[model samples]
Target: MVDYKTWMKELDDNTKLTQLAIPGTHNSAACHTALPSVQCQGESVTEQLKHGVRFFDIRVGKQFLKEGDDAKDLQVIHGKFPVKIPFPRLLKDVLKEFYDFIKDNKSETVLVSIKQEGTDDWNNDKDEFGNCIWDRYVDKQKDLWYLKSDLPKLGDARGKLVLFRRFGVKDDEKKQKFGFDAASWKYNTTEDDRGRFVVQDFCEIQNKDDISKKVKYVKDLAEKAQKSNDDKLFVNFTSGSNFFDHDCWPQQVADAMDKGGVEKVFAKGCGIIVLDYIEAHNWKLAKALIDKNF
Candidate 1:
């Protein structure tokens, strides 16, 4: 069997990072939740990596252990639904899986896009512990991450967790921050060098009719990226669900796209296609996205 993790080693060192085809999971760790609107994937983080998913969308929030407790820890969340495991546990699990995969196959890298979720005031520079989230999690684990803002060559990021910062940074003028600024790239935005990336976030699915429209919108954005001459990265989201109405689920959206001939739209290439319920259909959708690289 082909090792999808090491496939990037075949590409040239000068290849633009945006030009490569990458498979990603939207709300990657929400599989364990029972809520219909919150669950996005059926596979765990380790399983997704084993099945060729290189990019992960992770949301973290502050969680207090008890009432009036000054101490709090980060927890993974999907909208309002919180995962059973803490953020530190999730990070440890992912790192264990990632290091094991790359120890044997050293050509692959993981990109984690982290955003703040829930109602906590994450915008503050530091928490009650007098330490910023970056200092508590990212800065201490520097050896395991690729802490650079600019896109680098494949050779530079091998066996590393490339940070994609989707949250605000501290305002300290003396300290230098790392990771790609995902907030600068707005939702459903056009591609440009200044933005560094483009994203399609049509997440509202009200009815069965909305599924077809969402799929088409995703395909159109992907096609636009393929035709563009610029090198800005494109992140296409094929996941959508209604929270209040529950009219649609992420798995249903993914199935609709697969059945509606979505694979044919990526003949040229797909930058980074993020899907929900990636383990469904025997991982057929994920394989189709990875096949575009060849």
Candidate 2:
């Protein structure tokens, strides 16, 4: 059995990060308690780290607005649905999972992508999504995260969570410096190359057969990512879904992909291939990506 907890301990520090394949979860937090359409993964963030997943695609929003009760407490969300821990969980609590995991396993680093999910109060001008996080959460525990807009060496970021900020504030300098400038991600794009990184998030799987198209695109992009210069990060999202065919949903899409075309591609480093429901396949694909690094 592969020991995932300290998988990066063997990796070279001089490697320019993009040279390795890092596996990730699409919606890193949504559990089974959420509505089927909203639920993506079956496990918590801690379990994902223990099982070899690295990057986390996270969505945050204000929780109590629809109840006529509102606060700035950011909670995890998958689309409009709140990720449930039986009830909505605070973002700090979800983040604690990352902190705790990194504390015990200092050799490993995790990448987190934070995006403003809903049209809640936090999205308004009064609050401004990015500044709220910077003020309330980031200011308090700045040491635990790597907040630079550029990628760092594995040695420099080993014990911290690398923040890939996808939320925006009014200040251009802050926005530019706020973790790799993914604030305006191009959706369904085959390749959104932003100099330091390239993102391929084709996430609307409209039909059942379209799964093959997504699979091929993910494979092609991941292979392309491997051929790129070491400084450029390739984020190929293999997960996609829509409201139509049940197979187009996260779990079914995951199952189909589990049996699809990733086996050969992952034998070598394939950049960051973001997935969905990683727990369903017993961490097979995630572990495969990690293995390629060595």
Candidate 3:
């Protein structure tokens, strides 16, 4: 197997993106666990940063309000505030998996999905306003993942190295009309401490059916949650291909259906919502979760 540095260097050179340390701020607390770092060829590495796994340090550039301020009085917190920065934690976990997977095998090939692009539609103020009127409308992922790195360009396997985006939308007028972009964006600035952006609520669009329906569902849910004074909502979309679906996992049937369609359906509900982690060929039922939740 390639050394950790060699693997990282190969990724950097082939991917054309710089490695960055996950940043932090003064107000943010650190993880108690000393996450395992990557090591290869006598060189120890701190992260296994591929192109799709987005990383964000919630402590950098955080914002705060004085006590008793207009924004401070709102207290029915559910999805707002107490933002969840799952990237660093997820990164640590993925790296461990990567390390363990190739423990016995020398130079095992694995897939890495890095953030490629995202929309600049939501900023701090827009996020707050959207939260006021919408349920759990958090955009931290956009900044953390999308605005952080370049995703793998080709889905084809290279030297046992397999990587792809598990969640991505097609670039079409219909998809764009919903205000979700097909491209991922990387950040252009440095770090801060208090929290660059406070996340109210976040969800993945795991649902994989009808696009229009998903849009309507998400908007309606956001509206309903606002009326009920709810804090967060979860949304997700699914991409139906995996290693097995490809040459990596030949036994697996990797196919692409209307994943955007799936996300479109779940996007319609209100309140604190959670769509179960879905699997391939289950888009029909995943879409039905909208009916289950509604």
* lDDT scores in order: 0.71, 0.80, 0.24
Candidate 1 Cα misplacement greater than 4 A, ranges: 64-72, 85-92, 123-131, 172-176, 184-194
Model 3, 1-294: lDDT tens digits are 323322332332232111111110111112222222110011111222221111211111112232322332221111122222322222233334444443433322333322211222224333332232112211322211212112222211222223222224333332322221222222211111112111111212223332234334434543443343222221122111121112211011112213334234232222222121122243233333323222
Clashing pairs in 1: none
| Winning model by lDDT | 2
**How much is the lDDT of residue 294 in candidate 3?**
21
Q: After the best TM-score superposition of candidate 1, give how far the Cα of residue 66 lies from its true spot, in angstroms.
A: 4.1
Alpha-carbon RMSD, candidate 3: 19.1
Q: What is the per-residue lDDT of model 1 for residues 149-227, given as tens digits with 9 covering 90 to 100?
A: 7766777878777877776555443123467767555454333334678788787787889888888888888888788
When sorted by lDDT, best at the front, the candidate numbers are 2, 1, 3
RMSD of each: 3.2, 2.2, 19.1
Better of 2 and 3 by TM-score: 2
By TM-score, rank the candidates, best first: 2, 1, 3
Best by TM-score: 2
